[model samples]
Target: MTQHQAADTVVIGGGQAGLAAGYHLRRLGIDFVVLDAQAAPGGAWQHTWDSLHLFSPAAYSSLPGRLMPPQEGETYPDAAHVVDYLTDYEQRYALPIVRPVRVEAVHRDGTHLRVETGAGNWRARTVISATGTWWRPFLPAVPGRADFKGIQLHTVEYRSPADLAGQRVIVVGGGNSGAQIAADLAYETDLTWATLREPRYLADDIDGRALFDHATARRRALDEGRSDTGGVASLGDIVAVPPVRTARDAGLLKAQPMFTRLTATGVEWPDGTRADADAIVWCTGFRPALSHLAPLGLRGPRGHLLTTGTQAIGEPRLHLLGYGDWTGPASATLIGVGRPARDAARAIAALLGNA
Candidate 1:
């Protein structure tokens, strides 16, 4: 079609990773366009709960070129602050971003990859898929889950504690979201936190910044042909953010083993103990939102596309960004995405002979 519709590189999902890729592509003087599914500028940040807060400070949580401005009267910026920063970063660079376009699939079209979207089609020599995991909420298959009569929701559907306040609620999973949401609802509801195992809490001094640093060091070690010193996953599951720490110190953050099954009223443990509940909120986590790439046939058994660096191993012309450490260490976080984004852009630029 029109020249405006095609570029040397096309970035899918204009969130933190896409924006970071855009910044580097611009710096490298490569022609590219970013396609975003959302009607607005903020990516998944716009969809987070009102109380969600970054584990790191504003200075640590930022995209490539611009530092996220600190939130007023806040150390760790909240969801709204992150949204504002992402929106501002998108505008400041004037990156050519087309919005409200849902990409249906990506297909191999001869030498170029064709990105099929509801809006139209675009062909590019290289495609970067930054569609983060936010959209694909993973709910574990629990027996009798469908039979549960009370309200059941994933982290994505949760908004305010007032919505489930004063009710018997069980929060599932042991990740950061589980801890944070559990903390938020501890006193507000008759809350029960359930995890697959004992939750690991990092020292209060360790936050996202420390995790990012450790990831960087691990990447360096790997690149240097040294043994992986281990990344954040080696540390702990929870960061012990202010609220989580408060809850833990107050003896409110006790977590029981994940229930073996869901009963009509609530849940039952392996010991046959049961708890009645009005609602169950799952902070179980998410999988990569890669349905668009199904046409490419690159996914492995674990449901992740094989990649070396950010480039898809099976599809050389395609790259995956910000799905998590598989793309790059800490790549899912705001600060951790830049390195991989830059690497992906540089690889694309070199491939296109534009570097």
Candidate 2:
């Protein structure tokens, strides 16, 4: 026999998005519950490397009604500080978050949503799938990977420079993580950074300060769908501090074209370059894990849950937060999640006649 729980709304993840959703639902006087797989709050941030820190400043990282601790002039908060802030937020709001509960599957039974989790069965009138985009790390299949004698690890498993000290490392991918890792490793090890795409742009002060004034202006233009100029431009041109450049400058990085093949002793690059590395760290990226909701068929051709222009289809009670839009930046930040949360909460409240 399985235990059963009930709620008006069940939030699937306990990270920033789920917390935001729960916060809005509480304000609307909705009966809700947040189910998180981790033993505590703060989702993926809890599992990040010890030295990890948010590129955004503390000011921009706050959720609804919750603010991070003051560091005086500190632009970015490290991983520990972020976790601490999240823990404090939950306590402050008295949010009802169920932890260490792994949701195995979610399906709609008539008008109600059924969530099967490790704890038991939960039934709710609606479900907010705020599981986030980085649920699983994406590792590409490399030929002869099994035959390689060197240790290969994904970015998710990386902890710090000490883990790779003195080793000749090949760090693949040119994203933020790849760059940061290469920079850190360049101090002690020989590092090589490779990317499929030429390095993308990034803001010099990724803490959001450099573009704060500009982003605000752009936000207004984006909301109105108007053509306006003068804002902090996209981080596409400043590539010096990026991992590739940082590593190269430190005499720890070698520029390699995209990986073409893997051999037992080394890797082959597209330009016929070969390098033998003691280890390879794949900083490729991550994908959303929506396997449990496969029955809903809500996903688009690319496996992303398609929305009706940011509003969930069929289930107006459902809304996806934090999805990136091809034309704008509102889809990928904590601030972006708030709008969708507010919209969904308002819609759900109206539907319930509790507004």
Candidate 3:
């Protein structure tokens, strides 16, 4: 309600995507506020499994203006390293960020946007949502899921492998998290990896850097009205990180086709074979964390809101980021989010007459 409390733009989620938008908005001299739900600065990185590392090298995994400083002798920065970098990036620009502010919803307040939050309300001419999907970790409604008497966890709640020692564990999902967690847990537990389809691997030498480059080049070509050939990589394809490579050598990364259903103690294959498992870690990924925007009635039947170039269709005042390729090509990555964030900020500036 006060002059200082309101801003030309309010950025929700201060993670990579939100920080990138904040950086661009600052450079454009836009009066904006960023609301982060986390108590700290790292966003979802703060909550990842301890040994998690980016598949890309440090040079390729950076924010808008600064390259992520590589840890000495480290090819990829671990999750903690990333958190430190994000924390520093936030301070370097002095972005107007309010922390521990869980936004409940966004409402159309006449000509402006009203952000309802636990901390307080913020009214802005534009609202950019960068809340990535980590919070809404998805567990598929498998048959007998509730009937399974053993422990079941989503990757969002999984922190370390120490707790899984000597137990039979089924790590579900085929993506990077599945590989990485399976790699670590295999050393201490009887681990089985499960994926819907066979997991595709990039060439051992190719990492996130190459994947990002190829993806960007192809995206550029597509934007220029040219058919893109030589598609490099899918964002979902797992990279052969060192641990995963090691796991492969140890025969620990071998994946079984997804089981038809969960049994009381474990999972059952179509052939009537069952594996006894003490725990099942579902790494089945996430949906967009746009529950706060439900008031706008924008979600489609598939649970995704329609968007045209980052702006929500039929709602020009709202922008989305960091969910996945639908929002922007590779928008969920540290390096990939910068482009969309910049574009969103530029558009928001123009909308607010600050451009």
TM-score of 2: 0.87
TM-score against native, each model: 0.97, 0.87, 0.95
Best of the candidates, TM-score: 1
C-alpha root-mean-square deviation, candidate 3 = 2.0
**What lDDT tens digits, residue by residue, belong to model 3 across residues 218-264?**
77888899986555544447888999999888877889999999888
Q: lDDT score, residue 94, model 1?
A: 97
- Candidate 1 has a TM-score of 0.97
Q: Which regions of candidate 2 fall more than 4 Å away from where they truly are?
A: 1-3, 203-206, 209-234, 237-254, 323-332
Q: In candidate 3, list every pair of residues with a backbone clash.
A: none
Worst 10 residues of 3 by lDDT: 228-237
Model 2 poorest ten-residue lDDT run:
323-332
Candidate order (TM-score): 1, 3, 2
Candidate 2 residue lDDT tens string, 87-168: 8888788889998888898878777878888789998887777776676789888777777789898888888888889988
Q: Which lDDT values do the candidates have, in the order given?
A: 0.92, 0.72, 0.88
Q: lDDT at 295 for candidate 2?
A: 70
